[model samples]
Target: MKRRQTPSNGTMFLLLGFSDLSLAAQTSLFVFFLLSYLFAVIGNGLIMLVVTFSPRLNSPMYFFLTVLSFTEILSISSTAPKALQGFLKAGRTISLIGCATQFSVFIAAVNCESSILTVMAYDRYMAICQPLRYTSVMTVSVCWKLTMIAWIFAFGNAVIGFSVLFNLPFCESILIAHFFCDVLPVMSLACGNTFFLEVFQLIMSVTLIMSTFTLIICSYVRILTSIFLLPSAESRHKAFSTCGSHLVSVIIFFGSAMFVHFHLGNPLSPYNDRMVALSYCVIIPTINPLIYSLKNNEMKEAIWKLTLKIVALHM
Candidate 1:
């Protein structure tokens, strides 16, 4: 397939998303993505609402969980719509500005998710390892400050990265191989040298991902050590259980994120990349409410209470 070289000022870029696939496959993906997108939005939105209103959930952990749910909503919203459109139609076109905006929002959301997860890990560490000082260390004001920092860092990185990436001359081709304006796919379309941009992206990816991952790992290590030191096995199990949901979330998110960002030369194929991206963007957000809520007794209890209250009101 040949593409005509378009000027950098080209307003629209064709997203060649799954056009090569059979109609049946595309239609199947359309249905699947539509359902997944809806589930992700509603599930994450519900988690946020429950955590915000439930008096029993008024803790630093739940506060951070609310932030995480909000981030997941943003993450799914950024890519799932474009992806669904591409699956529904052969070639979906997105304006350059629109593409840039999507990329910025998605990147910010990803960054924020990682940062918030790290904060949650720290909260767990404080609770488990320093139980007496947990309240003092993770107070409401401090939690708000930390959450604000995450938001500021995410948006700052997104704005800087977007400005650099979009300024590049994309005279080679306008057809983004993937559904969304991902960094690599758009970078591949650049006509001139992208060495600086590539390095910048690498730096950003490594810094945001690995830094948060390391912090989480360190927090978990301390938490585990503290759990082991507990006198009774029951207490140890109880302490470990509290961190279980968060640990699972971290693993799922970072596993896919690392695979996508850390690899050279498309880790398998373009389709595989899309699948992995889909997992983190759509699957993760959709399943996060389940991971945090189903595995968590408090979350389940809160949901049950909230549901009953709604039922009574409706009755």
Candidate 2:
């Protein structure tokens, strides 16, 4: 609200998303991405079904995982469909209102993932550190509350971010650099002074992401310390195994998010940024179930049996 520029209310914005690619490349990418999206959907869908039915998975950890799968699905869906549409058509275009809405949903979904991962870290911390009190501490009611807070907080953050973006007067050239309506690229189009909003976004991204990652690192550090303190080597190994899947997820998500957010300006190229965004937003969620299947024996056993049951039913 500081500087003066005209607001392009309801003006259409064109996204320069993959339009530079050759016809053959675009067709090839479309086929590949279609398969990947289907796999991610089916995988996450299976997790939701199995967890819902398996009473043994009624524990806090699995409950949190169900919520995560749901979030990952929502997150991937937020941008993938629209991008696919972009590939199919001449160019990706959206009304200002549509851009704002997409921005809000994408931002909220990503934040939800960050919140859920942090909550999962706490679950692991309690399970390993205070095994006796883990149940009492993370009750059914408490899990619901924690999850609600994550969702609510995420949307709220997105709302605030949207407000900042919407308040700014935009440039005449309404072409967005990225595939979808990402905040930074959209913000970069603003004319006049946008220093405040830009700084606000950077600060928010740094603070929230760094703090959550710090908490996770600290949690794992304590868990590892406790594991090593165990009398038996087998017991220590068992403890480490329990957290392996979540730790790997943390590393991938946090590392990707950090690189994308902080490497925004001079250090990053737009081309590399697109690839990174594709990885975390599309590829990571798609492979999330794969990570669980390979790393966590419990989820592997359950998903494998569930897959067999479904196949047999079809037979």
Candidate 3:
């Protein structure tokens, strides 16, 4: 009789180190993530609603803002709920396909956001710096085309990234170290050597991130120079106020992103990895709508009107 080969221990599912988290800590994490998810959804949803209903927000800037809100909502939804469930259940195991799908969605949303932000900066430049030609330059057709390009670019990137992972044979290890199914964390679980894939992904990610960030920075610099040359104090103040919130949000999103993608080396500690992931994935999305709406007067008024209408309806 031929003997059957038994699966190795590494091939079997294990709890990994997350099982060591204290019960209180797990409970706290679950609650924290749950609240974060709710805020992310509600905040972005409100922004979408305001942009959709307000006639004053029918411009290109608000259109991009609506798309951004949608992207942020999708990005947070990709991982936060799963992480919360894992915290509550004390089980962190995810299937191979599930992890890959999560990563694909996340990468798509992130890449789309980067490109959309760059387009938004250009839109601001036209509106503030070249006001006379703004309407002509940024027509409805142009805006639609640009948005389509951003989505196509993001979808292509996601497809290519997932294709790379699809070819890899998973070893017995299915435990991902991070709270979410990030590329680095998921790649770490592959049984076979993945040095080439890791390097490729790192290069692609850095290139995309750096290029978009550079465009945003250059756009803002030019915008500032233009503002400074403005003869009217009121004009300068308006431009500064308009750009301030966007600048802060961009810094928070891109800065945290660059730090995690560029600074963190392989073989990351679980705690540090989870913390960094939470900052970008959970905290940033939850705070972005608040930052933008609070800073912009138009958005604030729109929200106020929306609230009044809802209250009046219930009366």
> Cα lDDT of all candidates, in order?
0.87, 0.84, 0.82
lDDT of 1: 0.87
lDDT over C-alpha atoms for residue 181 of model 2: 89
Q: Per-residue alpha-carbon lDDT of model 3 for 86-170, expressed as tens digits?
A: 7644556666566667788999999998998899999989888899999999998999999999999998999999878755556
> Residue pairs in steric clash, candidate 1?
none
Q: Give the residue spans of candidate 1 off by over 4 A.
A: 1-10, 265-267
Residue 129 displacement in candidate 1 (angstroms):
0.9
Best by lDDT: 1
- Local accuracy of candidate 2 as per-residue lDDT tens digits, 1-315: 434456556588888777787999778767766777788888888788888887767888889888989988887787877788888566488888888888898899889889999999999999999999998999999999999999999999999999888777776777787788888788888887667777777889989999899988889889888888899988988888878878888889988988887875443566666777888878888988887777777777887787898899999
- TM-score of candidate 3 relative to the true fold: 0.92
Better structure of 1 and 3 per lDDT = 1
> What are the models' TM-scores?
0.94, 0.93, 0.92
RMSD of 3: 3.7
Candidates, ranked, TM-score = 1, 2, 3
